[model samples]
Target chain A: MAKKAVQKAATPARRASDAGRAARIEGGAVVVTGICGRLGRRLARQLHRERPVIGLDRREFVGKPKDIEHHSIDVRRKKARELFRRPDIAALIHLGVMHDPRLGAEEHHTWNVIAFQKLLEYVERYQIPKLVLLSSANVYGPRPDNPQFISEDAPLLGANRFSDIRDLIELDMLAQSFFWRNPGTETVILRPAHILGTVQNAPSNYLRLKVVPTLLGFDPMMQVVHQDDVVRAVRLALRPGVRGIFNIAGPPPVALSRAVKLLGRPTLPIPHAVARAGVERLWRWHMTSFPAPELDFIRYVCMVDDRRAREVLGYGPKFDLGSTLRAVDEERWV
Target chain B: MPARTALARIGDVAADDVLPFMGRLWGGARRSVDELAVRVLGSDFEERARLLQARYAEAGGDPFGLDLETAKYAVMTCAFFHRLWFRAEVRGLENVPQGRVLLIANHSGQIPIDGAMIGTSLFLDLEPPRVIRAMVEKWSQTLPFVSTFFSRVGQVVGVPENARRLLEMGEALLVFPEGTRGISKPFTQRYQLQEFGTGFMRLAIETNTPIVPVAVVGAEEQYVNLGNLKWAARALRMPVFPVIPQVFVPFGQMPLPTKYLIHFGEPLHVQGDADEDDAVMEEKVHLVKQTIQSMINRGLKQRTSLFF
Candidate 1:
């Protein structure tokens, strides 16, 4: 498959006329894990236009595509060697790191880390040449000492705040270690900033809330990317000759207070200690939208430098902070 | 004891009634002042702003989100401080280049009134009116409204990446290489230069930016920082806790009005390996520190009194 990766549909890097330079998928099958996800659905559809795609997940995807084969099997419990018995699976795209609040700590581990390890085992057994793993920028926990644009070299510090997201850090290490160990396989780990579009709009939800409670003395810098851009980045990562970890954050980071003001929402300032205590209680009562540890994100800067993604994958974000905020505002109003 | 007294006072007057009155009074004054500022900026101000926008075209901040209407009001407010409050006199406006340059100044006083005055001078005194992004201390980023206020006004955390980005975007960056040591030094040590951190020098080399040495006087006389309480700083996780007698007095916490004099030295273009030894870099950084110190000494020699 001689595919020149188009990270975003409207990337200024790749003009419409130059589309001839990068070829689309011609032969071989593209295996997409967690096909039920909104991202997975779009990715499968986009990839399906070129060649055959096999989507593996536990439940059937909503609005299942006719061009793709939907395999309803839990990758962890089942053997993928049977499915790839003929051995034509070109790549495995894992988009299954679900932040479902209902899942307990143990369930999250099984769903995230264990499932990822199981998939890696299958990749080696099945000889999948390309692998793409999606990780969140939150893995680089927001801290007072964090650099302005945290490089990919920065340590995974999420375990310092929330025990729940510790698996994300472990998953990144596993992927990186696998990349180093295996000489044949090409692994791309994308640590994207806050994803705000469709279902993955946690930041938007928090920003849109009336009388949003913010840590009184802290306002973290926010770097968000549109869902379409994230999809585009994954496409570029899936392209041949692109490897190694990359930070995928869109530019013009806005302060949390400014984001709320842009959304026409008022903020309720609470002292850090008091807010932490209140959020802990809210989490205990199951009255909060997210876990208590979510407060730390708003309290410090978790911005990532996405220069590598732009340089290596030619992934330039189409939507900046202001445009993204306007989109969020319109979405909320409607 | 004050809590009981406040409750008794609230009990005497209906809480709801007093709250509304206070809110109405405050809101009315704030609205009129902002409106008055907008009006005072007058007709040609908008035109000038539109012209200024084109200059910052390459600047990598939120272009839609800058709120220049608010920034204008802020610049006007700072202009007042620059003209009336401090009676600041700035020299060598021509020394500052139109494009990227690093303004290295001697940091002074426990409070950062000096940095504000320098910013005000650049905005009001210079042609093209560059919106210089002041690199802020790391500890300040942890504070709530302060960080937001700083960022909205185009301030960023004092890190290599932030400075590099701003400079790369051809922004005029203001940095105090002395950092906390320079800003929080005791009153007795006023005007004396501290050991300059070589990071700025390294950054200067890396980005190929011209270094503009600045000296600010009279800020040291703002608040009498008798000394710093080290234990309190450690406990509070704050960088410094300066013990000033005025802090205990009623309505005396504000810095005393001190006339400020800012001098901009020649743009020193340094070229060397940023990866060289710290000792080698210190030799280069020492020149910048010395330049600021001499300027401060000259300004102090010309000063007549602490406050008018």
Candidate 2:
């Protein structure tokens, strides 16, 4: 019944906003934000192979892809679309999500939440046909009661657990709203579970640390997708007519202990009860990289069922569990 | 979670025997003790591994993440108590079928020792030893190290999905429908069965699995539940905090020698919709409850003394 109220409230606001503009089909160039990052640069290049793209970010791609026009500006402020070559870009790919834990709540709200709102305002104005938002599966939050394979429809209980998770859930909620409100903009939210590779990580505690500390009693299973697979999923989302939320998890869920071993690192087994308090102290002392609540991830599972992504979007992950585990950079020990 | 499949595929074989011999330090009475333990507890190492392998094959992975070697250690430890401490006598073993079945039993002892004894009976006493995967009480999941310990030992938290999936995979499931009431109810209501829940009946109907009514004798006197420390348990997020007065006294913590009799009834088949009306489901549940109640009565009547 409460959900009914949310739906009823969202529909009218959307329709009221849509009443002002003349109904028209959306088409033109594709605009990719966060184009300087590793994933963004590759995604822009892939999109550019099919059609022309306008790259949006404050910096240039280190090895910029061919024929992709670049625009330099922060999306937080005024009419940033003026820099675009054309008014109507066919799609908007948001990959500029900031993931550093050092950023406090206000900073996260500004860049992750408020700036995303500002981008949607631009998307609403342009009536962009498609929007592919790459979100993290951490939105599920690690919990003991979580099913072995959680589907996309599982509730978002992660927001209140960790301070950093709040922004991710907020961004997802905002995108979901946009998905329902403006049917014209086909918004596809890709919740990719722990993407492991040599280059990048998905807010992982296992990476960067020489000796990973895990709860002695708890060895939660993990579902990891390869970076290459994530690229393929995001590319599939940008295609002509794909929409809705999908869990972009890959095959053969691996336990946290096994995953650490596969990465060629040793682990320090700590008591599950004391681990939280110890991690909190370590976080406060600036000795540890992750926040206090992230200890929950190491203790409990947050794996998702991604068969929907394959069935609906035709996304096929190339790397199996073994290959993906092997792909992680052993030299990445920080 | 994918334990032996990939590792075995790469030819780094998981030892065929669940127990890896600890070199020469394991000599003397230790070797004789292990053999005596296995003989008395009644589990062949090879047979245990074979059972676990079949279970792993059906489940596609170590879904519960049970370590067979550790489970063997646990079984050996439990068998000492089950065989000597309780002197348990099990009956009607052939009534338990090979495929998926729910053993609806009355829980006692203010804890799960009754459940553990029942599980040991199936594992050690049966011809083709069956690992009875018991579902944990929901509150038990909140206990920090305890929950993980339970999972690693192949006991899952009692959620409907966990039960249904395990049943669909043709696993033998153990459920105490009376739940916390059956186990945690004060010692005054000890053998008196509490009102049974109909969830198990609905699940049995849904999966088309047979239901076996079981009665356990002598567990009721284990740890007397004087009263529940509701406030303390609530603050600690525990299900029920039993105020066992016996816990305070030295050697009082141990239960008095109480012989246990486990009687497994015929696998009664119920035909109906899983989502049928509550009245219909409750009526079926009552039938199973009555069967168990009668079994408990007979076991109590046949018991000659407390410490047999």
Candidate 3:
């Protein structure tokens, strides 16, 4: 509020040329997109105490902290451009990539890709020193022949079976190109494994089901990171000199059955063919959120090797396997 | 209403009393079977299983989904074939070195019973009981129970990365470099070494792992593969379609109980660039292949009978 007040009080000429330059003299604020998300909110709460944080999201940040600045505006809107013009954003952490499979392709594409393109342009123009995009390990699709541990250099093949993941892959590719084209910005792309926490992701929601459905006779090894661990990884990426693609895995890989057992859920195991057709029908009826293609995850190995994240980013998962699996149950009523 | 009440009462009785009674009965039966298995296989089997569990404790049992509990039963089942069915004579048991090593073996038998026998021999015969992790064909991973069974029994997908990771973890890896060609060879081509792939040699050199040439003498006689039906194999999306008349016979689905002789040659240390020219790597691979062939020949010469 004080910063905005000062800008308003300044003369137009002084603010036009010198306002951005002078504000950058102090350590710049970190702009966090999708701050309204559960993971993003957790990250904001952790980061705001140390440095200034500006939240950018279309939705309101409920129970927002006093010090953090919240902007309830669409990322592609002109008002969001006004925030970038301040030139005080030292880093931009993109966590706003929409991945709702139910959303129409046009809206999904516009929000995830087009909005990201606008943000990249701002970062390039403003010369933001750091850019971190929260990509996912799902970009490397589950395959029958995938090596047990996939490295960072693996191709983005998540869209082969599940077309819903196309936007996320596009965003990751866009960030990669941005990293190459703009060398000045320390662009970091984090590809964390299936995150199991209060965050409303597919893995978490699936585990939260009253009777978790699984493919019979298919128990692929899975790696699930905790939400807090992912938040920590994002914070580490925000650190200067930390730049590259890092796969964040929480703990040692466990079988899908083992994970379900850890959650203590009674599972309804269906054969792959029957489950696929059933899920397709249920999805069409809006009775189930899981698309049929997503069943491949439970059927094949899509785990990643987090050696790069551990060696370079110095990030380790503090949550053990048991707690990580149980996190989906936290704050369930909310 | 009277019929509905009677059915609901029967359901309630089944859920409340009959289920628990049945569960207890099943539990008792399973316990007796376990005891019978232990008595038949001897207490040494359980001891070896415990030792293996300790060995894999670091990875919390296994990263590749190797449930030692499931694997021990598999090993126990194979132990029967190794001990009684084929009565495999394992030679040069001490030749296997501790720590990460590659067992380059000849792949034979219409099925992979030879690999299972090798694994069983290593587990039952070798001191400290090393579990051999072999690489299964990637296509097998597409099969339902086969894939799960392979994973539980410590067989991984045949990928370079999986092989490298296994070696790095200081586990013994079994590589049948001949792949489908050697395993599905026609009866006329028996005893002749099929073209070995250079992948195992490259992996051995890259990981600085010692290569142990393993020779199984009697597997070729277990099931006589007349020829490979290429058209059928392609149509079925199978690696190879070996035409074995035994498969058509009433009891011939089971491999003939041919007396087996396995020879483990001394570990060979091959050092070179992993990415060296194929010709250079082939020389090293050829050296290993020739050693295996000679060992197989010697074992064949020493064996007195095919089904003794």
Candidate 4:
């Protein structure tokens, strides 16, 4: 599937008085954390068209600084004043944090939640008008019998450390957004399911050993969102009045078995107990020293109800599961 | 409701009421039959005779008085020929009112024999025989043999307009919100409820009719898909492979006669008053679907004997 640009068509300029008010302001700048990541790079590029985007990351992208400004900063280090010295930073997109489950509970708690708390404080200190936070669908846990697609109103069971941290971050974001009670400085928390798309020179969480090796023949019934959809959702979140958590996933849930079949790769169904034991052995051997919490987390299927994304945000994916799987198989990057 | 007339009440009694007194007469009659045929028939002749009598009662055939001759003939021919021997257990039968109510059950199985069995139970066991008008898919209307029988039995064609029309006339209508997708799910996805369309809720709200939740087990295990022919299905405009079960043909694509259990949960009363909120009604409908699915899962867990 061809990736459609997330940039909305330009509308007529504001009236003379409004234009004059806008002109009085200096350069409008947006701060994007983890801009070196797959989704972060797309968001930076899209936002840079209208505003000067500052890409903040601990690592560097291949061809990033050629057009946009890149800043190396760790969000957890309380370098708020140093990072916010750029006078034109009007909005903040918090995408930085450790997503690897190999990181233990304490590390994840400190990086994902504690760092987010500090970042939220820094955003408020800098008085950024808008904030877009990325969340995950892991909060819903597994519900095999729930054919209703696990709506937002469904009970959440965060059985692992990663999801528990995610839940806390979401709670904090919601609390602060409603604290000042200013709808103008809105906050959009997007809970996206497993995202599958091309990432140059980087191993994706989805493409890791646990899921990839598990994909023998038939795809497990899991939901995956394309990278472009994530970028589109971020752009939509930048628009005014798009608040609250939106479950963004592909058009329909794709089975992992079906996805492997689409890739024309054979899949072997390893029993859940056997898979768990294998991961434990890998951890003991220190072949990859990431914490096994995420493996434990993936054991519980993650599926979300995308009704709100369709009904409210006017956001829907261009491709269904079949097409998305084909694109992933072909390694097409947008 | 007033008491039935004395003659009518007496006629409503089962023929088995006089079995003890007439046992010797029937026993002698059976002995006069050919010895070879009797030996081949085995020892369940009495049970078979009782089943025929029940089927006759189901078809509105009375075994007493002047109607006995016609009833006996019907039993000897059609009833015996259509004899369906399968174990069935019904739950929440007490919640079904004797009036015109809307019955909504999950749809599965290629021919939807579950619907026929439920109709049989209602006609035979209910205090007053009730006719269950079910909404069948438009595709079924194009199939040979099925379309005519459905129409003859007063089944409504499953279109939005037809459904509303049936509800307008205050007829008991059965509909499967999952439609064709529910039935076509492979054995791997059996017993899991598919996404239910909101048409039933909309119709219930529009007509202010009560929606009774129903769950049927044993239908899914009847047909297990060994493999799906995707190209063939696409050419035929079908979504799944035609299933081949172990019972029907041993190795061919035919369905097995698995024992069935149909459980009807309590009726969710959609308020008839015009002032009922739409959101509240939708929530109630969702709760009803959830309740029925839970009941189904619970019943399935309790069923230890699937082979019988």
Candidate 5:
């Protein structure tokens, strides 16, 4: 039998427009690992509005949320090549890994650092155009007389155990970003101060125990970023060519005492050192026995200067510390 | 007793009254002082005698005992900015307490010359001069003249222990709550308040001291951060990328002589007894921070031009 001649036909104008729209969607498609988590969900929802979103989590999605497509896969166990077989992933927001604050240094190194390294290698091998990695302000250790404003250039002293973990992760991210940038792939790192907002199904986890208590007139002071701001920054990062680490924090910083006052709650002002010691003791006794370390979530003084975000990423916080707390108290998300 | 009496009587004798009579009797200078020297030791020796007489007269002209070494050093250091005409217009100096007040200002510029200028203004302009001990960063202690001079002038490292020690001693202390971060922030984020560390509050509460918030304008524009060299920072173990600026180039690595206005706000008194409740103390600290930030915002707003 003779081979059938396949004539190359020009796409119709209407079809061309459809293809163009499809191409844009494909270009903006983002693969978010760990979309089941609070932060991951928020990011997924935010990014889905602008692009096609594929959420990969270890747990299967019985029914997917609006606009988000889901896949069941453990990032640690699966190979990236096998996982991203579709080849149309324009960006990857790696939000996976067991971020258990209760984990020890060794466990954290294995789960966060070691797993992150493997992910970076995958990102590089796949030649992903953009990667947005979320970091925390914990990289900058606590100091009593720390400057009221911490810029990106502020010292990364990694004083405590948790800070050390964050510091290692930040270094890995930076190294990865540099590696990709050198090869023409763009990477954006966001060091959000303290993530605050609501999530469903999950227990009142890090935000409730660590952040909410402090904001409600506890002894500690913390800088916060609203969920909206965090999501918005991530969305902006999805646009091609945005690179560099930006500190995404709220407007200024509020004392836990002040936040409590605003919340119409009575505050107890124990000495910072005493409070920290108590929390550390509690973690040692019970919290760390879990898969994740609880004390890692309780750090109260993680602050950073978000000048770079304001200047470069065009990021301004929609909610300050006061508003963020009010939303939480009202259970806005739930 | 007799020797004491004789010494007292001699002290009472006027040297001026004795000098005229003694000069006439010693009128060998009437033996033509120059002529006598020339005849006794030849013409060459006369020139030497003339030089000696001129030196003796110059030494006798001002007999006040002034330690020239210390005076010279002071003048030299004071003249650091002498090459550039400094036009400092300080406002709200009255807000500064006369004795033992804590001066809290934002830290900026590569080197904290604003603190030095404020100290100098206090000593020179205020009556009954007061000394200022700035609570500086520990890293500053490594710099050559800065560490020694700061030590000599009673500048303490801004550690909690040092701050407590200074407050307990009833000395005026200057603290920049923003520390290195405030001064070193990229030029893009100017005049924004950083997260005020709690040390100032803890110190104030512990010592029951009042804080005088200071707003310094015109310092931010002094040395703009044109760019940051990240690789160099990593290589050198430096915290931030080294800032490149127009002022820090070629000869005389000095910041531009930007006009400075140090505005002082009213003192914030942490009320209640020394043993006030912790919540009350924290409230006071927050109020003070807000007050200072308000003052700074106002000052920045009121300025006609950073250039002027």
Candidate 6:
């Protein structure tokens, strides 16, 4: 009967948002934000070996670790809302979004949707029982009528033809309207897909270039994942009764010319209107960092369906697609 | 920088000596084109393409890409138009059962060569050799080598969530639902039947599958189309400008060998309620379009000559 009147008005709004706040949601201090990103410093060195991490980032956390607490401010400062006036912080993650394309579209919409809308208003005024966000599978874009896998209820249309992915699809629609106006904060979001390793994204800098190019008669079917499997799908979306929007994807889909012949490089091809007019004249002569509608991610099928993160956040991908395309030639240091 | 590591040691010695001698001369011209496709598809067409490439390499492949060696050279070029240009003659290939069925055909020629002669008679006369899949036109995934040869030959993108994930992976799909309106009708609306699309009877009543029907009969006289220009198919954004006067001659763009036949029928099963009412899925899509219009009127009354 209308799914039992939507489970009788969703069980007293999920038991009045799980009653009193003392369910610690796995004890204190995660915070993380853009903790000097290389995927926010490998998710703050694996969430500081199990909680109490903090970091936030205006950049300098370089070799950071001594019991991690960095905080170089500006997450749109008022001294970054004084570290959410700590109520033992347990989970805010956000992975500080930005994505450069040589910055200024008004500093990429005030650092990606006004600093993730002031960290979702300090994760809804610090009732922070977990939040996550990471947000990507390129906001559902590389289309040509998608559906090869797609599915986290599909439509974001990745900023309809890449208007510089409009603030990461408006910060994944402001973490899906703060996951419907915070039913007491288990937000989640993730999205994943083309992550790949040694993070300088854009499919790990188009599989660390030295020839790559493609699109001539477009190959498509892509997917990717492994930035330590998006830090293990943000540690299973900070666990405690997992929240929504999952998508994470990793190994299965391959053919963008067999992932550039499984990265043994050598590609070139061109002609999608001469590689979108030579990557839009080498991205307006700052000499290329891609963006010619990101060559419709090598021309189409965006790829996703991580079977609801392997049946609800038990997630999967422990790397194999030859170590997730050899983590973009790991440690290719200068 | 020491001349960029001596031009990365001569681009790593021409990627270790000219890409493995041009991948061993492209693997000896792809093993002499799979030995000229097992001497033109016979001697048990390489054990039915190695049992359908070990059933899609034991499922570690075909995540809607298929590539069983590009579907064994697109079933050796549609088994040369199903054995020498539409000499097709298929008939009830054992009413095509075995797992997750559907077929449902009747899309006339005008081009999908009766879906490549019913996917080359279920990959060259059935018995443990299925393949089929079909769907396509989601703007042929925006073209470029017709979307990588329709995803390495299994073909997909006519979404109802890719036909309920190729009928939940027990495969054999095909469909047609008279899309592109029965392959661009006109030759005085050939064997009639056009309006089908109840999205494959709500994907065969939401995946309890079995539908079959098929009935091809010489792809409605191959390419006779005589009409549809629809303002030059809306100024060339295409989906039907067909007016096929044997495509302005020359090789007349091939088609008319005509003699196909096909048929199949039997399987049906079809119970109801896949979110019911569209006048009950158009009366079970008019009982599978009146069983493919009485099997294309009993295969055009057992045809004796259309080019046979």
Q: TM-score of every model?
A: 0.82, 0.82, 0.90, 0.52, 0.48, 0.38
lDDT of 2 by residue, B117-211 (tens): 88888878776777778876555555666766776677876667678878877778999988888889887787899999988898998889999
Candidate 6 reaches a DockQ of 0.26
Instruction: Give the C-alpha lDDT of model 3.
Output: 0.88
TM-score of the candidate numbered 6? 0.38
Clashing pairs in 1: A7-A232, A216-B144, A217-B143, A217-B144, A218-B144
B94 Cα displacement, candidate 3 (Å): 1.1
| Superior by lDDT: candidate 3 or candidate 6 | 3
> Which runs in model 1 stand beyond 4 Å of their true positions?
A1-26, A204-220, A250-278, A318-334, B1-67, B228-243, B246-252, B304-308
Question: Taking the tens digit of each residue's C-alpha lDDT, what string does model 5 give over A85-149?
Answer: 45677777877645555546677677666667766767777766667777666666554345434
Candidate 6, position A295, lDDT? 86
Which candidate number maximizes lDDT?
Answer: 3
Docking class of 4: incorrect
- Model 6 CA lDDT for position A130: 77
TM-score of 5: 0.48
Alpha-carbon RMSD, candidate 4:
22.0
Tens digit of per-residue lDDT, candidate 2, span A1-334:
1234325535766665443321221335777888777677766767677777788787866667668888777876454756432555677889888877877878988888988898888888767667889998888888777766677888888866786668889999999998888776778899998887655553443654778787776776778887778888987876655678888987666667777887778889988668878878888899877777887887776878677788878987898877777666635422
Over the stretch B18-71, how does candidate 1's per-residue lDDT look in tens digits?
A: 878989999999999777655544335556566556554445544213445556
Residue A4 in model 2: lDDT: 43
Each candidate's interface RMSD (Å, one decimal) is 3.9, 2.6, 1.0, 21.8, 20.5, 6.2
TM-score of chain B of each: 0.81, 0.84, 0.86, 0.67, 0.67, 0.32
TM-score of 2: 0.82
Ranking by TM-score: 3, 1, 2, 4, 5, 6
> Each candidate: RMSD to true structure?
8.2, 9.7, 8.5, 22.0, 26.4, 21.2
Tens digits of per-residue lDDT, candidate 3, A1-334, equal: 1123233335665444344443442356999999999999999999998889999999999999999999999888889888987856788999998888899778888889999999999889888878999999999998998999899888899998888788889999999888778756768899999998999999999999999898888888899999999999998887755677899999888988888988899999898899999999999999988888999999999989998889879999999999999999987423
Error of 5 at A57 (Å): 1.7
